[model samples]
Target: MVKQERAVRTRQALVRAAAELFAAHGYARASLPAISARAGVSTGALHFHFPDKDALAGEVERVAARTVRELAGRCGRSEGSALGALVTATRQLAVTLAADPVTSAGFRLGGDPARRHRAGPLDWWQAWVRETVGRAEAAGELADGVCSEGAVVAVVAATAGFETLGSRDRDWLSRERMDRFWTLLLPCLASRPPTKEPRP
Candidate 1:
């Protein structure tokens, strides 16, 4: 049991170290040796946990996806309406990207030209946004004449842009900025603009 626990801790450390490097430097530049060094593990230990860089990146992406899904799920369950949940989720995602290196790396990896074929974190986030927007429309939470498709596109694009920009300046992911974005947008998207802004 102790051995298994140690192995799990080692793998977690390796993933975290890789995520930090991947977020700072794109996939093409983050080296295995550096990742192992950051984790305070030998190259041989890293190889035992992950055979190659791709495998390590894949694990990072998987962890990021899980984190996003949990965020979405919590927002969905806790909010009074779909539109409200969508707003909350978007705000939380920006905060998550800024605070969590693994998630930030996963998003960056998705857009990295080096990993062109991989589905990255944005794909999953886009899908969730689309689904949530659809639900809002179905429930009459959207304003009259507001098209769900257009709303989905706008939300996804804006949130993804924030993530990309946040990579360089974390202020882009600030709560005040996100609230400003929603302040401009929510009035148009929601049937009744929420009286109280969603807290991060």
Candidate 2:
């Protein structure tokens, strides 16, 4: 039991370390030795857990996807309007990307040209926006004449732009910036704008 638990901890440590390195240096540039050293684990342990750097990156992507899916699920379960939920989810995602190295790295890995077969974090987000916007449209949360595709494109594009810009300047992902984005956009997309002051 102790051995299994230690193994789990070691794996978690490796993933966290890899995420930090991958975030700092792109996937192609991040070395296994550096990751293992950062994790305080031997290179042998890293190889035992992951066959290669791609595999390690793949695990990070999986963890990131799960985190994002959970966030989206929580938003979906909200009792408020679908449009409200979508806005909330977008804010939450931006915050996560800014705060969590793993998530940020996962997005980078997903977009990496070398990983042709792997779906990136952006793809997952785009799909979520499509579904969430579709729900809002069906629920009559969208403004009259607002096309679902248009709404999806707008939201996804803005959020993605934030994510890309945040890579250079984290201020791009700030709550104030995101609030400004929603403030400008919600009225155009939603049938009725939120009455409550927007959360940061």
Candidate 3:
């Protein structure tokens, strides 16, 4: 049991270290040696846990996808309205991107030209946003003439942009900036005002 626990901790550390480097320097620039150094593990240990940089990046993406799913599920269950939940989720996502290196790295990896094509964090987020927006439409939360597909595109594009920019300047993911975005968007997107105002 102790051995298993230690192995798990080692894997976690390596993943975190790789994520930090990937987030800071992109996939092409982050090296396995640097990742191992950051994790305080030997190269042999890192190889024992992950065969290569691609494997390590895959694990980071998986962990990041799980984190996004949990965040979306939590916000969906807690909010009174679907649109309200979406607003809350977007705000939380920005905060998450700013605070969590794994998630931020996953987003960057998804868009990185150097990385091979895969359904990375952005893909997962886009799907979630689409589903949530569809639910809001079904719930009659969307304004008249507003189509679900268009809303999905808009939300996904905006959030993806924020994630990309947030990589350079965290202020792009700030609560105040997110609130401002929603304030301008909500009036046109919603049938009625959100039940809860944006959190201060």
Candidate 4:
């Protein structure tokens, strides 16, 4: 147990260091040796834990996914509406992202399946979003035929798009935009009332 704990600590440090460097310089620009030095680990030890840079990226992706799972677990308890919970999660994600650029970078890098740790964190988010939407529907907060899978994909895509936009347009990433996102998302996920129209 003691040995396992020590190994876990070492891996965690490596992920933290690598994440920061990758976020700052991007995955292609980051070198393993720099990551090793930043994490205070010898190159050999770093190699032992992660055989290559891609492996390191995988670990970072896993860590980001795990963080989302933990956050979703907490958010599940809210008695708030589905739209409200979704908004809350988005805001928290932005804050959490600002604190840990490495994890955030993982998502950006994974935006290309041909590059980076492609699916780790993203898969986790997809599952969690599906589950959350499923729960909301069960509580009668969503309409019939409201596909959880579709909602999950939409939310993830929307988030990735916003992050991309935020990276480009710093001024647009705001609390107000978050609210606007909620406005757009709720109707998509909500049960639309039957509409009346004049006969053509």
Candidate 5:
């Protein structure tokens, strides 16, 4: 049991170290030696846990994907309006990306053109938005003229834009900024009733 626990901790450390590097430096620039050094693990230990940089990155992506999936699952089960849940989820995601190097690295690494086989976090977010918005439209949460596809496009684009902008300026992920975004956007998309109180 102790051996297993130690292995798990080591693996986690390596993943976190890799995430920090990947988030700060693009995948092409992040080095395995640096990752190992950051993790405070020997190169042999890192190699034992992950065969290569791509494998380490894949693990980071997996962890990030899990975080997003959990967020989506919570929103899916929310009793509030679907649109409201989406807005909240977006804010949470932005906050996570801003504060969590692992998720941020997962997004960056997943989206890197150099990545050969890993799924992209942006694609996952876009799909979730498309599906969730469609449900909102079907539930009559949207204004009469609001096109589901159009709304999806706008929301996804805005969220992606936030991710891109937040990479350089964390202000983009601030609660105030997200609340302003939802406030301006909701009236145009929502029905007569406000979805939920804006995040403070």
Candidate 6:
């Protein structure tokens, strides 16, 4: 039990250190010694915790995925329509991507196909968008012919494209823009509300 606990603590420290270094320097530029030093661990400790750089990279993605998924859940409970939920979620993610170095760097690393072991955090987010959009359309909140799959593709592409843009000097995709996207999407999905019956 003691060994397990110590191991867990070591792993957590490594992840935190890696996140900071990777965020600051980008993944390709970060080295095991640097990460170990940042975590206050020996190089052997890093190797013990993570068999290779790929393993560490996978762990980073998992951490990022957990963070983003939590963010997505918060979006769902937020005040708004289903479309509103999606917009809120995405906008929050965008701002975080722009503001947080760890998040931004993790995603950049996840972009590499050879390195990724998980569902690709970006892909997961896109799948969420597609599912949410499909549900909203089915519920009569969006315009007809909205094309849930295509919309997912677009949202995924746009989000990544924005990420690749490195969050510098961009005016688009503000909360307002997200709202606008929703507004344009709604009319086609939602049918008119049924008229109320006459009072007796």
Off by more than 4 A, model 2: 194-200
lDDT of 2: 0.85
Q: Please write out the lDDT profile of model 5 over residues 1-200, one tens digit for every residue.
A: 99999999999999999999988888888899999999999999999999999989989988988898888778667637788778878988988989988888887776677778568666788889998898888888999888899998998888878877998999998988998898889889988654556343
TM-score of each: 0.96, 0.93, 0.96, 0.75, 0.93, 0.74
TM-score of 4: 0.75
lDDT by residue (149-196, candidate 6, tens digit) is 766776677778767764454455355555565466444544542122
Local accuracy by lDDT, each model: 0.90, 0.85, 0.90, 0.71, 0.85, 0.70
lDDT of 3 by residue, 86-167 (tens): 8988999999999999988888888888999788878998999999898889989999999889999989999999998988
lDDT at residue 14 of model 6 (Cα atoms) = 88
Model 1: per-residue Cα lDDT over 97-127, one tens digit each: 9999999888888888887557767889999
Candidate 6 displacement at residue 10 in angstroms: 4.5
Error of 4 at 96 (Å): 1.2
Off by over 4 Å in 5: 198-200
- The true-versus-predicted C-alpha distance at residue 132 of model 5, in Å, is 0.5
Clashing pairs in 1: none
Candidate 3 residue pairs that clash: none
What's the number of clashes in each of the models?
0, 1, 0, 0, 0, 8
Scored by Cα lDDT, where does model 4 land?
0.71
